[model samples]
Target: MATRIAPHEMPMIGRRELVCLIALMMSLSAMAIDGMLPALDEMARELGAANGNQRQLVVAVFLLANGVGTLFPGSLADRYGRRPVLLGTLAAFAACSIAVALVHSFEALLVIRALQGFSAAGLMVVPYAIIRDQFEGDAMARLMSLVGAVFIVVPVVAPSIGQGVLLIAGWRWIFLSLAGVSAIGALWLWLRLPETLHPEYRHEINVPIILRNMGAAFFNRAAVGYVLGTSLLIGAVFGYVNSAQQLIGEHFGAGTWFPVVFGATAAMMVLSNIVNSRIVETFGARRVSHAGVLLFMLVSMVQVWASYAHPGELAWFLPLMAANLGLLGFLGANFGSIAMQPFAHIAGAASSIQSFFRMFGAAVVGLVIGQAYDGTARPFAFALLICSVLALALVLFSEKGRLFRRLNGPVRQEAE
Candidate 1:
């Protein structure tokens, strides 16, 4: 029998186990995206990609479908329960992985990849909902930061893992490996995760209720602002991801070094999350994130100047990229935590709506940036500058021009 527990109940596992479980669940999507980076060239050649840029559609389409899929899981999880919905999504994700391996054409593969992303959206949404269910404000942020600290390892090593798979077998084996991983995650979650959605908090899964809840999230000024800011920041990250391979491999002549550079930059994000976990509780999310966004804009400006001055120079570009990613790591967990703070009663819907717009909008911007790749880092650098400025503006507007004001709440001291 399933363990039925209230949303207010603590997680069944120990602290370390909880962090690992949450990180593993979230890593499903990252592994899917980052692991495919190394195989893009081989996959493109075999699948009849129309142009070098066209291969980017493989990543962009998955993100789009993942965003669209975010619209439903939150409401479903609210109505039914988190555990069941997550289990079903993980099963579908595994199935999609298998289907991807059997596909022949690029178009067919893209279709399956979209389905895979759609299924993976549950992993994206429900975990945040679960986090909100049990914690609030800085406590939640700290928990998320820790989860992110561990989760960031997936992206750091995923490209290298994909490269290893390429050395020994076809790219299809990559998806096969993902399937195995998803299956194991599903099994682990089923055995260990307790139900967190309290019965009293459950909402009806109807059109009217869903629309009303979504409107509530959209109209909440703080939630909307953070969501928009998070979207713009994510757009910049997507832009980088789409261009990194080309910039490093083609422009810098580092095909074999792509994974090393990417992994090193990803490590910066992990380090930032570790720092965030330590400081977010004492200084507050707003204070830390405000400083982060401003620093991000400044760093982006430097990147724009550097790109123009030293075109194709890895020495200048790599450090700047790491700094930008580090700032992003600061924004991600904080933004999500703040945006959902006011909507804890509707965490599922709020998380869904926030992530849908964030991922979907970012995918659109990233797609444009990816297609604009012209054997130079100028476009990528410029996109980062614009995205940072826009994000900072949204954040300012959200806070009513107030940068680091902490919201009124009694700080809860969480046990380690």
Candidate 2:
């Protein structure tokens, strides 16, 4: 008999190939935010955004747009092909990046920024949808983990990269850099990436069908619950991203070193990703993610107390931020996988709807929490705590109160 090779055993990606590809796709989304960090102050000054905190609206709006974008691109990828949709979105994103860089007024920037976000929606969801298309089971988890590890490096290094550009050129160049990067990504995809959606399995896109699929995803008890929970998690993360600069720059008086501390905190996410990748197969995503949420909740409470107790110390603040972000790496990938697992049949529509809700939810949270910014870390801490509690509640309800039953063994059943 001929020997049969397992899917995982097949040598598909060359060395660093997977990481580079994953990083490239992930960077499309991360650069949208990371590259803008250093430019925030300059942009605010140039555009005359009202308050220092109000500048964060640029980041929040983009995230919300990303959520909205995620909804449709998935279906388009499923219908037409992943390559064309991704390439189209990247070109759109590049155009918006240039627009953001050139715009002179705050109002104009807001509109352009939102469009940039809308463009990003395709970038954020399609990459994962592509991965899910190629791999599943333990292979899916491992690839996701590697992708998560590479994904986090953007946040770790992007701030410094942005700051470096700020030192040489003006803030406008930051957007230009993003535009250039997007163009490169588009070119790369055009050359190397192939269509992952098989013709036999592809669905025809229709208005009523999309609506029905979206409605089904929303009504699915497990899917809806996980989506809501994931939204809260994203909201908490957006709240932090919106306020991180202010907390580090104004509150801690870190000045130019703001990006350094921010990068450090972001780097901790890599640690969590490593842990998640190593254990997810052994422990299962459900067990790992459930524990991560509980851990996140506890850490948030501690952060709230610490921020209140010692209002002006980096020693107290950095550790708390690191721990909080580290746990998020574990929570993010697993939650997304678990949520999409039940909707594999309509992964495109499901991804779009879920992503839209998550991003839009984050925007609302970012806006509200950002308003509470008072030149202190207190608001960030409190917002995280509240969001964590809500996420925990949703996860519990989604699991039908059996959240921890999978901790000791493989989660043999679907989330419901």
Candidate 3:
């Protein structure tokens, strides 16, 4: 079957170009999320947010809408092909960004943000399918790690970029700037990215065919729980994004350095992805990711302690939060590669469904944690601990209580 083709069995793109292009494409969603973070306060003040927490809803509403939108694009990509859906969404995303800049009220801003998020969802879904069309197992995991390493650069600099824009102009310019960035990405894809949908697997846009594909993707033992588990694990990361300005600025006293501080924490993720890319094939995704989940729980426990012990001390809180995020970087690529290993035939449909649950569920989890903030790190720390523990349980269930054993040997690399 085409799904079981050997690694690099099909046509190839220039490895370096492919990696960089995919990274740039994936970074659009990250930029959309992290770029506006610096603008939250300005947006709240101008739009008349009821309270500080209301600002978080900007991120929350976008995420929730992005999650909802994940349900369609993959299936559509499977039927219509990746290139068209991707270009269309990029255009739509850019249009929405402009709309967001022109909006005058908090409600209008959220409505535009939600629309932009749906476009972002399309951007998020198609790439995995594109990757799966050519790779699987440890090869896919390694490539994902590489893509993540490059992709994470956006989050690290996005806040700084947003802050820079805010310094010279109003928050609306941040949206406009990202809209410009999206245009560049769209043009790049149009000129270079080829359609990756395998001819044998061009899913017809129909109810029964879609259901069958969905069933195969969702019911598989290897994929479903891991997808859910990943959703649970990532909730804290999103939670952190939601409350970052409040936590780093107001509670920890970073003040005007909040963007710099946020960038520093995100920088840890880059290092983690680099390390994961290096060792994932050697140690195996299960062993590495399982260990990561355990470490995340342990780190969460310590983070909770430091939160209460030092209270408002940035010194104590920042490093611990950074460590947990670093551990998350280790888990993110591996978990996705694992869940995606079994569904190459239905990669588009599967990626969309998994992404839906991952984003929507994490958004809900983030909403809870973000809303529970009370000017202290304890609640956030505790939520992280809870999410880690629950994620471990789900991974354990996915493995039927098995842990630390490699199931599939990764294929040899071809210098890609």
Candidate 4:
């Protein structure tokens, strides 16, 4: 039987363990997207996909599905329980992965990929909801930082893993491998993880109640602004991911070394996350996030200028990309925490709705930016700059132009 401890006696889960669990959950999402990168060309060729650009649709479709899926799972978790809902979602995700691996036609694969993303709603949203269930204020910031730190390792390593699989077993093996990983994750949760939400804390999951909660969340001016900000920021990130391989392989002549260069930039994100984790306690989420938004905008503007000046130099291109992505580590965790702060009572529903908007909005923006790819980095740079500007505007508007406000002093702190 699982060990039981009173709520008060239960030790605050160690930062390492919490980060690992959340990171593992997040890795599931990254693995689904990144692991398929190296295979896009081969999959397109084998499946007879019409346009070269259409290969990107495989990734975009999944993100779109994930966004649509996010809306329902949170309420389901709130009503049923986290563990059961998560398990069910993972089961569906695994089955979809298997289907994706076996499907022969590009259209069928696209359909399966979308379904796989839809199944990922639990993986994408629940972990944050779980973190919110247990933490508040500075504690939540620290936890999110640690989670971000753990997450940093995923993007760095996931593409390399995908490339390795492609070298040995072909692209289909990537999905097969993910299916196996999903099964293990599901079993681990089934065997060890306990339900975090108490029976008394459970919310009713009627359509009326869900619509009311969603409407309230959507109508909140600050929440809506933050949600749009997150979406635009993530849209920029997805735009980069969708085009990174082609930009590196075709434009920069990186070829199979594409993953190596990709991973190098991704490593910079780890450092940024560590920095965020350390300073968030002292500087507060609001201050740090505000600063990050400005820095991101500056970096993106610089990238746009750089791309315009020296469009073909990999040396100039790579560093700008690294700096751009590195800043995202700072933005990712803090935004979620800030957005969810006011909606604590409806953490599940709030997390779900916010995640849905963020993912769906990003998917749409990213897909458009990606389709504009012209065998150059200019499109990516332009997308980043536009998104960054919008993100800054939203942040400023959301905080009523007081984006620079300090935290209400530091509270209890934790180790980074």
Q: Which prediction has more favorable TM-score, 3 or 4?
A: 3
Give candidate 3 regions above 4 Å deviation. Answer: 1-12, 409-416
What is the C-alpha lDDT profile of model 3 across 279-393, one tens digit per residue? 9888888889999999999999998888878899998887888898899888989999888887777888889988988999999999999999999999999999999999988
Query: Per-residue lDDT tens digits of candidate 4, residues 1-416?
Result: 01121332253555467668667776887889987888889999999899878899999999999999999888888888788888898889889988988999998998899999999988988887777767766567767878877877878888899989988999999999988998888876776566776555578867888777777665577667778898998898888788877888888888988888888988888888888888887787778888888888998888889888988788998898898888887888888777776665566787888899999999999899888999888888888888989888888888887886754633221100
Clashing pairs in 4: none
Backbone collision count in every prediction? Answer: 0, 3, 0, 0
Candidate 4 residue 356 Cα shift, in angstroms, is: 0.7
What TM-score does candidate 1 get on C-alpha atoms? 0.96
Report the candidate with higher TM-score, 1 versus 4: 1
TM-scores of the candidates are 0.96, 0.92, 0.95, 0.94
| Candidate 2 lDDT (Cα, 0 to 1) | 0.78
Give per-residue lDDT, candidate 4, residue 96: 90
lDDT of each: 0.86, 0.78, 0.86, 0.81
Quick one: RMSD of model 2?
A: 3.7
Model 3, global lDDT: 0.86
Deviation in angstroms for 14 in model 4?
Answer: 4.1
Give the 10-residue window scoring lowest on summed lDDT in candidate 1: 407-416
